[model samples]
Target: MKIDTTHLLSAIEDYIAKADEDLRDTLENEGFVAASETVRHIGEIEDALEDVLDEDALEFLERVKEAEGVDEFLSVSWPDIKNEGDLEKALYEIFRQKFDEMFRSFTFSWILAEEPEIVEDISGEAIDTITKPAEAFIKGWSGELSRIMNLNTKDSMEKMLLKAQKKSWTIDELAEAIGDSGIRNHGYRSRRVALTETLRVQSYAQQESMIQNPLAYSKRWKHIMSDNPRENHIAMDGQEVFKREMFELTGRNGETYLVLCPRDTSLPAEETVNCHCIMETVENENALGMTADEKKELREKYIAEVNEEYEAWEQKFKNDMGIEEPRDDPSVTWEIYNSYYEAYRKGEIA
Candidate 1:
């Protein structure tokens, strides 16, 4: 089949534009939940375009003709190119990889939309491509379009963490390293707290319901809580919450006990940040070598610790926010309580 470069390019550009729009929506809404799906679909479309480009190698030859400033050149047939099939395959593979890389650039922007520190390093071409439709026509295909862009956002974050670790920096330092000044300054504390508390309540409700209603648990919460509790906490909190949980499973030989312990939020003035209290699990006698009964006792100890930590943190948050007294009415769910607390603290709802 003859390749249709114009049609293929148009389709690719259109898909890319739609992908960019979706990415923007994700950014504006802080919707990382939907980001990977959006990017995956865009990647699939880009791959199809690469296939079209491979089939239409003649269009590339036409570009070469224009580049050499010749009205016409010897028409190069597909077979005339050296190892044309392998060459076309290699070219398309390279093109697809490059397109994926570009898509990743946009994806990273979406990921970090709240903080655009990397924007300066992004290419004008990338920005333009994301902002406008691809050019109507282009007659050139010798070297690949070498846009200077980095798509290794995960690597960047890892490097930042490593640098911070080397310096023995705390969570506040780590947050700053990742361009999250809000975390450092406790600026997003309210939203972070609300999100964290909501997730925590949902998690607690699911777990309680799981014990009470195994069928409902199997239907709804089973898969969600499949991870080790600490990891599950991290996934739910994401970057919005910078707290950590440690789980230790203890039991006698052939028996199992669970204990949960949560570390305080590592941010400076964590109390002011309205951080969520974490629960840690301590397992008995399996690997960590604690007796089963000891594990149970420690679990209770940790719960007490968690409550004490939260009480202090909550008191400070209230003080900073100018909440003179804690709410006594049972009507105060954690979410409503924190929202009111945050508003009062920020002087928004006073």
Candidate 2:
């Protein structure tokens, strides 16, 4: 039996787009809170630095004053001033705490609510399979956030110190530089982390739903184009593979690796960050446990009912909007289509 997937794909895409917007708004607010906390924590670290200026710390500063460049300055360690270690520990804790808060506020229940309509056939036992990947993603993402934050803290500290030495800054000036770094550097990183994680969760939940559906036979990867896209990901666009198989990609270091899905959490940030790819399922009618005639009757009934409902809605939309000139369709203009589609999805239109 041939199943037309135009409506299915379109519905899923529309649902995902709305979910992405909602997730982005929620996560962006959380990111603002995290960024503010990061700045406050950095201020406390700077205060600790001022309080620890004993003789040995002063000597370390003098050496830093005489140093030629960042490399030379870093070679002379301040054994007495323990703020660097303390700052590392503080940032690491902040990341872990913030990530946990974000995860707690997120919910996966909406994913399952839409599964029966979208996936068509999934037992209660199979529905539970969707959560396993989501749980694994959360664990992996939390660890990755801690690792990135720690590395960023170390790198920013080095840059702040080097800038101070080059400009002959006083202690207060150096502290101000560090404070500026905290505010300027972390704001974007917070937003980026929020966007990446939100998209990853949505993708994982949908893909797992497809995997559990009895009619789903295989999946295909479709890459989205954007400015400064990754060459490797672009190459993988439109590649069809079985649901259980992996997509092989070569890393920048020329090492071959495999990923089960586009935003696989086990992979590094380079491969997954800001990725806009999607996975679509290829369905098989034979797997539905129906005879040929029964399958044909079911398909026809489903398509006819959906088409009738959609056609009436489309005519009403065109008349209400007063579009006199004939175009290919109302969806030819994306802005108009999106507004009406979103309204319909929200049940604003009868």
Q: Estimate each model's TM-score.
A: 0.20, 0.49
Query: Which TM-score value belongs to model 1?
Result: 0.20
Clashing pairs in 2: none
Question: Given candidate 1, what's the lDDT at residue 86?
Answer: 44
Count of clashes in candidate 1: 15
Question: Per-residue lDDT for 285 in model 2?
Answer: 60
**Candidate 1 lDDT, 1-350, residue by residue in tens:** 97769988999899967856765464234322234544454445445434443344334334333432221121232124322344334433443454334333433343234223323354655332221001100101101211110112223433544565567665544444444422123223323432332223222322221112111112111112222333333433311210121122222232222211122111123221222332211122242554445533443354355445445555655677677866642222233334433443454531
Q: Considering summed lDDT, which 10 consecutive residues are worst modelled in model 1?
A: 131-140
- Highest TM-score: which candidate? 2
lDDT per residue for candidate 2 within 260-308, as digits (tens), equals 6677654678887877676666777665665545543443454355446
Best by lDDT: 2
